[model samples]
Target: MPILPPQQRTDPHPDRTGVRQAEAALVEHYPRLVRLAYVVLPPSLGRHRRVLAAHAVVQRALPAAGSRVRVPRVPAQSRRSGAPQGAEPAPEGAGAEQGPSGAAYGWMRLRVLRAALAHERRPRWWPGRLPAPAALRPAVPVVWGLRLFPRAGGVDELALDRALSTVDGAVRAAFALQLLEGLDASGARELLAGAAVADPGDAVRRAARLGRPDRAGARAMLWSGEFDPCTVQTRPSDLLRRRHRVRAVAAAAALCVVAGGLAFAVDAGTRPADDGRGPAGVAAPALDPARLLRTSPDRWADTSRVDFTAWPARGGRTDDNALLGRALRAWAEPPESVRVSTTPGTAAVPPAEPPQLLFADEVDGAAVVLFHDHADRVVRYAEPLSGSGGAALDFARTDDADVTTGAAVVVSRTADAARFLLAPWIAESTTRDLLAPDTPGRPLEVDPDGVTAAVPRPGAGGACDAWPVIQLRSSERIVEKHAFLLTDLGEPAPTHLTYMPKPGRGTPARQPREATGPDALLAWARTACSLRALAGSGVRSVNNWAFAEQKLPEGGASADWVCTRADTWRGPGRVLVQFLAPAASPAAPAAVVADREDTALCSKFGQHVLAATHWRAGSGRWYVLGAGSRAVTGIRATGAVRGAAGGPTLAVRAPRDADVELTGSLSEGGTLTAVH
Candidate 1:
């Protein structure tokens, strides 16, 4: 038989009543606090870690033995004994004089939430150093504890868990608080905002959709088992020893490096020249055919290679033609100086073998050639032409070597006989749509070899109206092509185009669908309403009082609602819908609207309103009433408003004392009417 240790005795400390009260609160609320912790702690932390974190939170918040307990604030009872005007009466069972316990409970809950959020943000270093209490379980399994009813048929627990896992931590927390704790979106946002959650409203909305569970079941399954009171069993002495060991090691390492020298040394002799050319006598590597074709002219040159040809001509009009001329000149020059070899006494050196031709084609009167030299460089040369040119002035090259084997060419046979060759890698099977609607020339043929041209006969518009024939000379043959007529070609060409590599075969992920137009927005509102109903949330009209009061843009569409029953777990829900017509669709009206609703049984007090109206065309005017004496400034209409025969005017009126402000474009030129 083992000898028993002396019995432990409580200290005879002051504030015994406070200690007992704190103990009583802890005993009653510990389980709920643990549940909150399970939801708030990062899901990445295992069940044991979550339980440990929850216990730590409670230990930090609850009053310690022999500690002073502060009294909680309680609302004063009415002196007259009857309910005051516009004030709600206390419940029948409620005491006339209540202790601070209610307020203390709220504070404790908040403290637990705050502590959980802190743990989520900065997890403990040694989460599993101490064993977790067996009674605690992860909140996920008991998430149903917050639900009013069991999951509906076809609701998979595993799937729900996966969906929750996909949501961001902050969003999950906000969603859990709203769904499990009955917090409104605004309240959740406030709590999370203090913890530095970005876009709390957005997070809440995302969570609401992702966390929705089927609602076809009856009573929820209650968690059984007695929960043990949270107790702190952290070994501070062991932690202190570890900290001391780490500090000693760090100090020793610091001492060892105190007199160390810098590891790197500068060597000017080893540095490359400012021009980036290799050292003297080092021959540049032979250009690989693939590499040369993919390299851009600018990358090959150290300095700007803009001064090779005189085709642009000084004082020439600064237009696409001039730019194309400059580009052609740059392509003709090489970055490295060409090495010449000859007998010491010979005065003449044979011209280097004509560049090995890779491909050739003719556009208008210009001859385009793609060729490479032994120096491992490729050049695109456009032969000088006499006629006016009509080709678009854009150029593109492929940076990828793997796909640079092919070439593309665009040809026009219309009055504007234009032709151009694309870089090899950019070129593929010829039949690509190279001309935009506004492009000067009409496409005749596109092929990998190069574009052929169709010559134009003389027409009324002088030589400019007539398409010319372009002659191209290849090693084996001379090719002739007709060119497009060159006229009205002074406008700047569109920027170059790039083709991204195709993605590998796989099912693409689905993105959340958003409503873009008025019709779509209304439809979205209906769908959201349906979803709310399915989750047992009552349906309300999309155009309710909150919506009718705001000055939405003319022809614009918007949808807003609150989703309380968004998930199986009962919670307050809120949604905001705002839409604007595409900026490119000027004729379309731009509209915005903001609406708020609480789906919970107990309604929350507050309203959010946002609205904007499309501007009217012409010199029209409008006025806003019911929004105090604020002036309605008019905005200029952009793009045509579709179907507004004479540019319709607008008028709006609201209560003179309503708390509303107009933003964005306002309608103009309409009768001032009161909004009744």
Candidate 2:
């Protein structure tokens, strides 16, 4: 063999660590190694399979005795004081790796990384031969019948997961090194290079572009169970199939098997039912259709509670056992083909118990069922009547729902229209175009099933030319009947619209009124486009208030100062203060003065709001104008310009682009800050 190139030194030496050393390292760092593999594994395998595969990769990474590979020292501090389980290990300064334990840890880490990267590689195909079995098939480290997954995380976790899914495996490895191993860019790059990444530098650069959070944030998210495979929630997979398997075993044993097999059959049969409860010793949470919580039809009339708890289960298909069973099964373990959607920050998980049935009816051409978890979420499941495999599920947060916010729900939606299911107490329903303020509302037809006729959707054509809003009037007598408007923001539940009129002096701000009539509709038409930002954002209601009206200095049209606030179900509300010039076109966007969050201004609890902007008048003169709510007794401007007003509004003649700090003296004797 011609010399063999002088015993090539480029190749790595065989691992020489003893089995006891490797075992010791693995025992101490099992969770950390599994987390690294979990983050590197492709998410396309789904959470359950990825979890099992991650554990397998780490276990297989243990090298046989008598192997040698030079690696970074594991650091004395790590052995002396290791990170807790489900936590990222801290990086340490370079030093001598004193023991076989340190080398074993590094060796195991590299093996896990290589195995993960190899798991993602595409197998080479040979002509006329079947493809080789996947290196790490999902079934390899299988636990029969159980689906395991990490605990759910908030929107940030969801966002990071989604962002990682879009990139390649090498970049994921780089990120895992940084996120799970506390490695710097250089350190990660070195590991990737050792793992044979095509371009380690490129992978590290791409990983940095993932909008990775700072060190603290990354550690906090990594600490969550979403990234840890060791700790997981377990649920039975394919309940229907499991039930059939149990029955088949029982039958086979009844025929040809002996007493031992018969005993096995009995144990299997008595394990757990589809409803998660067994025959005699059952104690699991109920998931059966018969166990669904229902309320009386007239419960809303007798109960003072105006939320979804008072809503009765009324629909044509409520008694359809086949449909109800399918709905329940889908909720438990939805098929991969089922279209699942959820609002921001909503956890996508199976119900812990049978949810309260809200509605189950046929609308348009599909069968729809709605459920309330009796907690934070309202879920909707729909399937086509003509069964073309078109099934959809949607989830929206409704923990903050009240009478007005819970009045109606979008039962069905078409390509360009939506049908609402009105509440039992709703006596009348109609549609009005916010753009056409003077036009009378058209009556909306409701079927016997309480599903309204299809109404044209706003911004359907990708333009804000027409904004259709639904007006619902309660049945509690004319004088006491309250009418509110609801607009669909791409969710099953529409957002409640309200209005607060300008407050009078010496009077606290009044409770918000139902957003109806010409004035309210006109104010909304100019600001409806802004609602797009809150679409699918778990908004419960939105309120628009006329805080102040100010006269312009050079005989210009009076401008209306309105504050629009959108309250969400899970987080702080959005606030926008706009200055609308009268001469602006109907579709013209308002001149925004301030946009903020979590402010008490324009809300019933807090009445004071102030904003200022530099504007050019009709006469071409520039002035700094400040407007505040009625509670403001005086307004003053400082910084780039100085001016003062005794009342709640101020117009100071100043140059263009002048910056000013605004402060207001409240009637209640405290200083009020501007919204900005």
Candidate 3:
């Protein structure tokens, strides 16, 4: 019933060959597209904002443009190529990027990217393949992306996302060049030109004009593309290429990234401060925690409180110590979230107004508050737990920040006397034989409080146990001849307790067994009062790397318990636990090796230890885990020297001045070549 309008006649479909389409699209939007392409690098850069404008513009235009394009055909092949069949067209013959000449640049990029992505060659071609990420034709983004779409021999999610989103050749090329190549505008242009794309865009053109390397800017460009899956390591193929490519890019892209670094590109990933040697020479290799306030002003993400533009400018580089000191002072001041009130009182210029508060965290997302002391000594302030015992705790600095910021902790308590466990000393300790030939000179010292001082004692020579000796404190004074860690079941208390002191956990690498003490606690050299052999034997060492009990003290009963295994190291000898029974009789002591399986189970046995004992070498006595012979008097004889497997290695003490070595493939028995 409807009358048809004059028969619509469609002009014979005009050839939209890939090349024609690429060229035509370039003609229309080369400038716009090139600008868009250049911004794949992130805006996080410090200095240059080359493509930010382009990123915004391209994002807008991409959705509206008729971007679909077909392959361009060669004149000779056009006749035999079935009009639209057999041979896929080449992506060739376009100019490289130039702001003024971007059309030519965009066109050229179109060709190369098409060829690269398609696994096809341009005219004047003999068939050959490209860098295929896969064994098959073209390359897949992932083994899975291709398998999911089996029809497409070459498959990639980034490619699929790009193709599905943008049909424009110039847009497609831009995405590939900026993100895939990790290039800044100028850098991208140079590479694109080599691949035959013309005048990229104004952003790139400006970077090229600079001539000198802008490494910072280039890195910024690369990161700007970070949100796009293609740029970041999204797949296994990218991971495999990372190591080799890291070296290659480090060599190839150092200069361009100079600009990115300056533009704050590195801030996104924490680059170092500059020294002004040169761009490369200026930037530091670490992100100072003090400077963290400059970048992340608010931990809770309140934009209203922090203006990104002026946040870093708020406080011109506060000293790390000053920050920590102030934070500590602030922590000590209030009961909850603190608020400062100022009146018009003239009090000597109002205490020199405090720096803008970047963040006033109470305990800083960590159990302990970490900061640098005025002397540059790294300090901690820990949150206190409800006290059941240990009377009081101590707060102390472990090491200087310039040297180590290892496992951070908080200073919860301040005691007259303090205990410490040094990592490096423990790492290097060669604690093997504690059973001396004769009743060793003196008994290991322990204090009423749990602190076992490992610091170098007055006038000492060799390291005790090749480490520091454990000391206990009675109130503020060092308690002599008392080792609190070891709790002897007999009337005379045992001195040495668990070897290595650490948080308690379940037995690892072992079958569940019965434990006799309060909840299994961290393995300290000091044994529990219930154990008989440990009575009066100074608390010695805990097998930190063993699969024994973990809980520290738990009212005499807790979780799964197990014996330890022997663990030996090549250079450091071995670490293990020993059980000394009713010290009057030295025959029944047992031992357990700490590094039985190199910590096959990490949760339970993940603690370090500090211990000391005496070893006689010639006339000189060496106190294990201490500094010199003076501490040798602290050693008490134990009857047994057991290996890691919960058994005795020797029933009686070995002769003094004898170099004893455990039997192992790595042990050949060496002398104590002491090097002070």
Candidate 4:
């Protein structure tokens, strides 16, 4: 492909593209556009914030309903050379010729650049009512309790990033267009002008002075996870400050309410604190054990719903008022002595109405009470049988649960074991080691209350010797008869595990079979231990999909690329892409190429995934190997040992730690960059 002259004539009023067309373009080229915005945004905002702000800009770039967006068309010369007349200009950086996604990609890129550049400006009162700067305003998709920053690179990326930060946003934008968008010097200037830059020529000149890196070095610095905002690592966000702020606001609110009422004192001679209410107080649910909502033991048999709503209240301690009252009071307002904890994304507030009593039992010599709130939260209150002051309250989010996932809850967890309270539909419980697929499942002793005896927990003491999963059998007619798998992830509720057949296996997306059989057990063994990363992240279910397999170069056996996605009860989810080598140890960690949140890649909805890793051949030579899902029609590598193939696999001989960029061409005429 020849490089044509830069497109001139920054069309002030470009041709309009339909909303649907722009949306298609946005979805197809999402990562590229986001990278564009991330590079253009000012570094002062910080990497994590810049990443979130970049995503926000791209997501909000879609044209409004019933409105068409102005998108620039390819220059006349390019159209005459090859691209069709009236077609939208292809993104110079995206490596695609004119296509349906080209026009929309251009429009979205323009919008992202404008928003990112404008974000650097500050609102001024004297500037004829200038709009508030985007930097001063908050960006959407905020994450609490986690600091998300992009993956860091070596000294080269750090130096370049620091250098770029020193320049103005316009110059940074011009530089990024050339490096990331694959734009020529003149093309960068022209695009910057189209984005409404005041001095495009000056910006381009300043950018040029930085000295462009070689093709391999530029791709290594730009295309690597270094500047990709979508992929990030999470750290705890100021734990002490967050706690202090929460306590301060709560204390202030309480003080204001009490002070106001006392100061006014006009309410019918100041009514008593209790009025006519019981000792539990008006702020909490009725304290009496009889007031607790309980369903019949057989309610699950006839109900149309198979969720937690159908779980019957069980255990011999249901009539114990003293224990029940303590549980109820602790839930409403836990004392400082009572340790309270909530999974990520779970609200820490009390229930608005009376909660459904799922279990009030004595398990492992402790009085445990489980309540299901209408807000999709499951709360567990536990107190020692010795009447000691030690009590614990735990909250977990469990929204949108069905029989397969909501069938069991961890009632008690000891040092080396955990006990589960199975649902009414569960007939038998057993445990199996995923690593040893040939071994039979061991039976678990379940008491009459549906609470199982202590089963050995896997991943104890941070060692992945064995990965244990509970195999549940359902006896009820309403519930599915197939057995399912559940694993404890250090939470009150166990995360459900499902398996997706490899692509082209004639398996439907929605019907992910239970993680059973030798094949699934083997596949899961490679990734089950990885669940430790999601222990307290409020994950609801994890689905494992063998997305791709490629024959290794140099007479090595084939390798598999498995994607394990943990979908949280909260909307956001996390994905892990692993490269599993043949005959590797079950306890050996998979080579993770991509691990990030809020992405649809390798998911049931988005079946496409691209990843690369350096592997040594049997002959001891180094090679850069890449693989993609079945939908990928071809794979290509550039910079430092070029390679191209007609299928989903690519292998090129290179240095041991070469800086290579991998991109995949999809059957639908779209392209995808390697997972960051």
Best by lDDT: 4
What lDDT does each candidate get? 0.32, 0.72, 0.27, 0.74
lDDT of 3 by residue, 1-676 (tens): 9987998774343334444544554556544354334333222110022122232223222211233433333343221111222132222222222222223333344333433433222221222232232223332222321101101111122223222121233333454454444344554554445444444564354333221123344333333432222222211222322444465458447754775657674456564554323222222111122322222333213221111111221212234444444344443332243333211110111111112222222221223333322111222333323433211111222111111112111222122222232211111111111222122223333222111322232112232221112322221111223222212111111122232222233322232221112222322222221233222222112232222222112122222122332211110112233322223422223332222322212212222121222233334543121111111112222333422211111111344432323321111121111111
Q: Give model 1's TM-score versus the native structure.
A: 0.25
Per-candidate TM-score against the hidden true structure: 0.25, 0.59, 0.21, 0.61
- In candidate 2, stretches whose alpha carbon ends up further than 4 angstroms from where it belongs are 1-285, 387-389, 460-462, 477-479, 584-588
Q: Which ten residues in a row have the lowest lDDT in candidate 1?
A: 490-499
How many residue pairs clash (N, CA or C atoms closer than 3 angstroms) in each of the candidate models, in the order given? 28, 6, 123, 1
- Candidate 1 structure quality by residue, lDDT tens digits, 157-251: 32343344445667766755665555666656765664567687887777665432221110011111111223212211223224444765686
**lDDT tens digits, residues 271-384, model 2?**
322333433323223346766777677878775457786688889788887887777677766788779998865666677556778899887788899988744588899998
As a whole number from 0 to 100, the lDDT of residue 81 in candidate 2 is: 23
Candidates sorted by lDDT, best first: 4, 2, 1, 3
Candidate 3 error regions (>4 Å): 1-290, 294-676
Residue pairs in candidate 2 whose N, alpha carbon or C atoms collide under 3 angstroms: 14-68, 15-67, 15-68, 16-66, 16-67, 16-68
Q: Which pairs clash (backbone N, Cα, C closer than 3 Å) in model 4?
A: 93-181
Candidate 4 lDDT, 1-676, residue by residue in tens: 9999998865343443345556776887888888888888866555666788788878766656544334444343332112222333323332323222244466567667877787767442212111244334445667888868788676457546755665788998887777677667776776687678999999999877553324346555878888988888876643544565576579668867876777587676665453323333433334445556676788787765577877988888888888888887787778889999999877767654567789998788788999887667889999888866689999987765677778999899887899999998888789988777778999988888899988778774557778788999887586556789999888888989988767764453334678887768878877877888888787888988887888898785888888888877654568998888876575466777788786545543356788888988778999898988877889899987788998888888999978999999987677989986
